[model samples]
Target chain A: MKNNSLPTDVEPAKTDPRIKLITAKIKKENYKPDALIEILHTAQNAYGYLPMNVLKFITKALHLPPSRVYSTVTFYHFFSLKSKGEHTCLVCTGTACYVKGAQLILNEIEKQFSLKPGQVSADNKLGVSVARCIGACGLAPAVVLDEEVHAKVSSEEIVNSINAKIAV
Target chain B: MPKISVTIDDKKLDVDVGKTILEVCKENGIEILTMCHLKGLTDVGACRLCLVEIEGVNKLLSACTTKIAANMIIRTKTEKIKRYQRITSELFFAERNHVCSVCVANGKCDLQKLGYKTEMNHIRYPYLFPECNVDTSHPWYVLDHNRCIMCTRCVRACGEVEGAHNWNVMNRGYQVRIISDFDTPWGESVTCTSCGKCVHACPTGAIWPKAIVQGQLEKKPEIIGELVEKRKMNL
Candidate 1:
């Protein structure tokens, strides 16, 4: 593939020294091909979801096509294309979990939060999604609160769990 | 050639410098289980099964792609490595529509063998019964999307090895999938070489010859290694 020389669609960073510092550090690391995912993670941690500037800066630094970068960003689920809330709740809807009533639990969560799957609650405290099995089937009907798994749960149990998290 | 001394599974061996731990282990008959790694392809390191602890490296590095250094200490079968491998294999089983008994690749699938080898009797994770379409559109092959592991070996083989650029991954994360170019159906994709390379490259029964659907769903051809090598030369 030819190296892309065209200007990128992602916006350039604002004149913040912190941004400059981060970019400088990334540049110094030399952005090896294998480090692409890690770089995206670091970029998101620093700039929240990959905004135009971060994407453009990454493109310019890596000398990669902007579309190629964007496609990669879209390929991996770990990379978020949009901003996330303070807390995200992922309900496992994999077969084992589903057989154990994962959907019912998810419905209860959505009802209590007044939102649908993959939506952020009105209060912005929780973001909900129905995930594929997260490899915790031993704990079927598992709900991931942030990154922690609460296993072998029921709809009522999930409601209580969310209420507890919200209270804290 | 420079030599690097590394300890794996407590056995000390000196290996030629610059080879990945995987190449060394394979050459030395030290088995560290892995999938998503076909020799000589770009190591995407998607499967975390080959992770091993390297002294001074905090995170586990993939043996398939990480180059060896002089005097490196590595542990391949530590409790942590075993646990992670089991978890990743369990996840693989849970995420896809792997009903082995009904599937054509039941006896010959690598995932099935891995499950047996890992002693995973039951899926601890929930099963994902994602709705899938089985495409028997191609004249010579059947594309069963449901059985796909999404390793993209076929896509890589088609694009990088075959020079057809016919296959590409579409979507992200769990939703990520292999697609023929232009969102066209497998039967309709214009770029496909009809070389049957992707079908043969598949690890599961996701792609197989159409005529042999019932009795002919066979293990991937062992010739894939040579095919990959030949394609590299041609490319």
Candidate 2:
């Protein structure tokens, strides 16, 4: 006889170690709904981006509606629903950076890689994004490549750096 | 409830203290324009159409959210307020694809009526023709993001009245959107009860039933307030 019923012993806690970290954080916060943003920060760090299954698990643990959790997650800029690729290039486009040559850098990168802001490459190797400012006005026209900030960069320099990172 | 004396547009009136300026204005037959405010739902003051000039305050305040205080001198009809209202109406038109000629809520839309009320003849700002999606996933309803002004009335009506938190706003700034269950299709939503409260709550043609075509959509937003009042009587 075919066993139509699924196995009851399979648990996400045993398969994924990241779920344990989230569970520990939830417990540390006493499952309080006010701690949702803090818990989401931890979950985003673990998964790189928030997945649907993880959101459902968090919603269930917190006893909140799915829409409430989803709304909070999408309201903030720090959280992301999709993967930001393995390597990221964040260009500053604030008033200071825009006064410098930030747009030129963006144009050069688009010409070289054919990837616009908020777009990932075909192979998922690099993602390009633009931020209003990183509060580094002194370093105008700055580009953050994989968490490392390059200050006062020209279009050619940014292109070279992105090429080096993508090549790796 | 205690009464407070307030002068609105040079008219003296003694009204209830806890009520908002909009409420007091409505009771006194003073015209104050509003779009995001539905009587039953909690006032978010999202739309800036109901701004009124209060004495001693440099900045204009929204009438819907600002409660009436003792001896508060308010001016609902002013040259400055009219200019701001016109600018707001223009911005609303420029922000989205509000082409009323082919819209479902053409003559009946609140935004169109607001434009006429504010004397908005032309839009000064450049139109941002951003690509928007029309989600027809729900069996009975459709959510067209093109005509949305981000008033959030539907979001509040779904959560507060229907008790089904299926609709929510996602993202921020120009990219903000109303999502159904984790940004999935509405038909695939697990939380939505499909009570159609949002359809009636929407002031624009952004949300409508599937059966209705353009220019035939009718909404009864008063039903939300009536339902809330009925619930209070039962309790």
The prediction achieving the highest lDDT against the true structure is 2
Interface RMSD of each: 8.3, 9.2
DockQ, candidate 2, comes to: 0.35
Tens-digit per-residue lDDT, B96-212, candidate 2:
888998888889999999999998889999999988888998999999899999999999999999989888888788888888777778888898999999999999999999988
lDDT of 2 at B83: 96
Give residue B133's lDDT in candidate 2 (0 to 100).
Answer: 88
Q: Each candidate: RMSD to true structure? A: 12.1, 5.7
Tell me candidate 1's fraction of native contacts, as a decimal between 0 and 1: 0.12
Model 1 Cα lDDT, one tens digit per residue, B1-235: 9777889888999899878899899999999897788754567777888999998989999988899888889898888988888888899887778788887777778888888878787778888877777777778877777888877778777766667766776676677666664334677765787988777678888887765644567655445678767866898
Chain B, per-candidate TM-score: 0.93, 0.98
lDDT per model, in order?
A: 0.75, 0.89
- Encode model 2's per-residue lDDT on A25-136: one tens digit a residue: 9999999999999999999898777766788889889987787898898898788877777889999999999999899999999999998999988887889999999899
Chain A TM-score across all models, in listed order: 0.75, 0.86
Query: Quick one: RMSD of model 1?
Result: 12.1
